[model samples]
Target: MRTEETPLGRKRRARKINRVLAETYPYAVAELDFRNPFELLVATVLSAQTTDVRVNAITPALFAAYPDPLAMSQAAPEALQELIRSTGFFRAKANSLLALSTRIVDEYDGVVPGRLEDLVTLAGVGRKTANVVLGNAFGVPGITVDTHFIRLARRFGWTNETDPVKIEHAVGELFEPSDWTMLSHRVVFHGRRICLARKPACGACPLTTLCPAYGEGETDAAKAAKLLKYELAPGREELLKKMRAGATRAELRTEGYGLQA
Candidate 1:
């Protein structure tokens, strides 16, 4: 994927790679389980330095205790810490959630702001976090440049920029705004399940020919199969078959899928 080409040619190839990913993971989403904007805002903040599984495990309790900005704004620091202890950096995260909740209650009238500009103003919310909230919660198109997105974008020759904002702008130029949110989901899903940072399952990946960094990990199909995670893991065929049969992501979530958490 990292090859010499005209700017237009590179953009064309990038869209093609996105198409392959779209096919590979038809059930792609943010992975975090949140019912509304406030939950998503808090979850995305807690998601830093942790996996979605850990965050999801704790959100239910956290939300049960403090379901909204007004409620969370008054949460006891010690209680919040205990609830989110598994996500790591609990103290810092607790402070963030408390501060942001207070701010939302005071400033936004207990409603999570849907605009990116307003979202970024909250404590612990950056472009990535704001984008997640804007895209998923508000139906606003945004490119979330998380670690997985940055690595895969560079490897796919989509952009040479290292900064998240630069990468977002560069990649955003390649696809329509309508494609931004879904494209982010697809790229992150591929990175999590196949194009792993340390041991990518390149052989099992659909974008092998489109990936410039192919063969950086095990390229043998059988060996690569062991490297897959989540829905692509061994013995997960039924999930894949169901997805192929037009199962909605919500339907899979209801059936006790691992990602439901």
Candidate 2:
């Protein structure tokens, strides 16, 4: 069995993993496209139990039709349901969107509330959604403990707790507040690209040396490379070539890639 690290050792390892993630995904961010907090909030809600790409596919038309809370609040329920039908749970999601939009208009005067307390008070909003809005929209740093983040956290030996709030607090103690939001993005990116849910590309992972669950997935370079996604995949071979040429571990570490030791 793998031995657990001391508290300080765990903290050091967590920061190191985060640092490598920072280099691997220098510009990592939400895949869901949106122009404003309201759009992000709506898109994120639609994103539940669905892919971000799917959410992005539908949002342009959705946003064009209901550009703001007041407009969204007044949207015809059937029309709204049809528009978001592809995202799944159309009726319930539609109800949430309309109810939340109505709340935003009636209570917050059409502006999506900036405060976490206020944001969560809106219908269908939760801590995760609130964190996404706060971090991306308001520039407030927050740890979004999504499935990806949660999985990576445990794999990297950061936290054992499955409860999102507990996971958030546990991992939160490892980094500076300013790092929380980007940290979430990087971790999520790594989870999707390398440390995947079913079969992780462990052999191609830059952090395999630091990851506690290193051998849990495909550990052959040829096979592992086949498992990469998006820009890290065969379609982006040229970009991967360029990234490999320049992004060395030493170079990445020099760019504040890992935690201070």
TM-score winner: 1
What's the lDDT for all of these models? 0.90, 0.86
Worst 10 residues of 2 by lDDT: 252-261
How do the residues 139-257 of candidate 1 rate in per-residue lDDT, one tens digit apiece? 99999999999999998888999999999999999999999999999999888889999889988989888778888989999999988987788888898788777786567767887
TM-score of each: 0.94, 0.90
Task: Give the local distance difference test score of model 1.
Answer: 0.90
Off by over 4 Å in 1: 243-261
In candidate 2, list every pair of residues with a backbone clash: 19-257
- Alpha-carbon RMSD to native, per candidate: 2.0, 7.1
